[model samples]
Target: MSTPAAPALDSLDLALLQALADHPRVGDLELSRLLSVARATVQGRLRRLGEAGVIRGWSPELSAAAAGFDVAAFVSLEIAQGALDTVRDELLAIPGVVEAFVTTGTSDVLCRIAAASHAGLQGVLLDLNRSTSVVRSTSVMVLSTLIEPRLLPLLATTAAGREARAPAYR
Candidate 1:
């Protein structure tokens, strides 16, 4: 079955999201006080957002680097014709393959991998190359990340009717 559309967020909803983003661990009572709304309102809005899939999870974000996976790379995979499902299953079996996307362009599958060292990365690459469904693979090591993953700016822009400029990163 197709998923239903997410509810359109209003100004108050945006404000509540921003407040929650700023203080993820704060209690609903505290959030109500900060947003100048009743506890019930906060609870209701949060419930709606969660039900609509706007809030996917409450887990703390973890860093691969801080977790001792010091090396990272983006691997572009050219897979055998109509082998996406098989290749995806193979990719998922490898722990070092952190993220993957099926794309439209020169390559079919794009993967972000994390490893403890260059040797470890090479081992992961070798494992990828062993997959029969993968026709070819190319990769580039990440020297540094200019911008970490962010969603608040896009949320703010949507909330402001796409008129507000995103703030400069510190």
Candidate 2:
């Protein structure tokens, strides 16, 4: 079954979200201290937040450059009309594709690919061009990454606010 969508948050929920944003790995006790709430409250809220899918999970950020995947490319694809599903599925199956999204404007899909070298990127580009659903593609190599993945602002706060008034909790 699909997970239920998370509810919205209020101001205090926003505060908690901001606190977590500052330190995702902080313990409940530390979070309580930072938010000036009870430790039990923090624990309970965290549990609810996780169950509601507001807090997906936490992990340390790793550098691709350090890991030897120095080459990055943003590839824009023009998919044949009504073939987005086939194209998206194929893109997802590609080994080097780190992210993919359907988009409006000039391109039907945008994909982020990372590889250990330029040769690896070239192979990915060639494979994309050969895909049956892809009409054309443009790849722009990334010189550097200014920002990586992070949580959406106010996600936790919105969840907290909704939990506060949820009938089940009440």
Best by lDDT: 1
Give one digit per residue, the lDDT tens place, for model 2 in 21-108.
7787788899889889899988888787788877777877667778998899999999999998898789878888888998999999
Candidate 2 segments whose C-alpha is farther than 4 A from its true place: 1-6, 149-170
Clashing pairs in 1: none
How large an RMSD does model 2 have? 4.9
- Per residue, candidate 1 scores C-alpha lDDT tens digits across 1-170 of 88979677777888898898889899999999999999999999999999999998899988999999989999999999999999989999999999999999999999999999999999999999999999999999999999998777777667677334446562
The ten-residue window of minimal lDDT in model 2 covers: 150-159
Model 2: how far residue 93 lies from native, Å: 2.0
